[model samples]
Target chain A: MPPTSIKSRFGSRIRSLRDDRGFSQEELAERAGLHRNYVGGVERGERNIALENIVKLAKALSIPTRDLFTDFP
Target chain B: MPPTSIKSRFGSRIRSLRDDRGFSQEELAERAGLHRNYVGGVERGERNIALENIVKLAKALSIPTRDLFTDFP
Candidate 1:
């Protein structure tokens, strides 16, 4: 599979987790101290998000960083 | 704690995993299709490595991506 596939999967995982937490994109962005547009892009699989950002998002979502990779094939 | 601390811990984790696998920095970089310098920077906690690269490294190490975050505190 192409590299982007992994990104897309990761993005989807983030989106689903955000949804589970009932966090809107803006809410998640604020919690993670990121731009809303950036969070939206991540949800859409348009960004190759860095590890720091991943940690930020995981912290905002109150989940372990490894949770972000859960269910990934 | 500073954000760099997380990066530093992550770098140490990667470095230890690489060592455990008996892979040199150059070998791991080549396997992950990354630059040796980039891998070195990551191992030294100087790089905010992106998800694609993280996936590459995990694959190179023959471990699930979640394993990269193992023992992360």
Candidate 2:
């Protein structure tokens, strides 16, 4: 599989989680201490997200880091 | 929590996994297509690893991406 697919998969997962938690991109960005544009790009699979940022997102969403990775093949 | 702590926690988890899988840093680096020095840095908790690289490492380890994060609290 190509790297782009991996990123897109991750982005899709993040979006699903955000939606489940009733958070908009801007809300998630604020909670994660990331820029809204950056969060949007991540959800769009356009950014290669960093670990720290992932951790922030997980914490903001009150979920485990692994939860973001669930259902990924 | 500080970002450095998060990085270190992730590094510790990687090292534990590598040990469990009987992989040297060089071997893991080769498997992940990352630089050996970079893998070493990550193991030492000194690298803010990107998601793409994290996916590479997980794939190389023959494990789910979530497994790398299992013990992190």
Candidate 3:
């Protein structure tokens, strides 16, 4: 929407998923061993995280890491 | 090691990527329109972000969304 990067796009998706599940950043972070701020950055498409964390994120979020890219390019 | 979730895995990935790029959570958040805490959550593998956000994250991180899952299951 804003000529965003992968981070921004992923950030939007993350927010949607979180909202769909009625989860707060803090709640998700607690379960994922992550910081709420990091979740926010991801939602806003502001990060460049690595692979291992991707798996960690998928597990914590109850989604597969591949799911994060279910519709990726 | 912790049977971590996707969020945790992704969170770890994010941290590694950020560390690799020599960036702090705050720096990435500012660029991605995300909250730094949220970025931290993702790096710690704590969130179930959506596909779109994944793209944004990958972009912000200068990676392809598909690459996010380059080593995913």
Best model per DockQ: 2
True contacts kept of each: 0.59, 0.75, 0.35
- Candidate 1 second chain TM: 0.91
lDDT of 2 by residue, B1-73 (tens): 5554878888998898899999999999999999999999998889999998999999988899998888665
- Give the residue spans of candidate 3 off by over 4 A: B1-73
Candidate 1: deviation at residue A60, Å? 0.4
| Colliding residue pairs in candidate 1 | none
All-Cα superposition RMSD per candidate: 2.2, 2.5, 9.8
Q: Model 2, residue A62: displacement in angstroms?
A: 1.3
Error of 2 at B46 (Å): 0.8
Q: Across residues A1-73, which tens digit of lDDT does each residue of candidate 1 receive?
A: 5455877888899899999989899999999999999999998889999998999998999988988897654
Interface RMSD after interface superposition, model 3:
6.5
List the TM-score for candidate 2's chain B: 0.89
Per-residue lDDT of candidate 3, residues B1-73 (tens digit): 5675656656677777778888888998876678888788777667676544555677778876666665456
By lDDT, rank the candidates, best first: 1, 2, 3
Q: TM-score for every candidate vs. truth? A: 0.92, 0.91, 0.51
Measured by TM-score, how close is model 2 to the native structure? 0.91
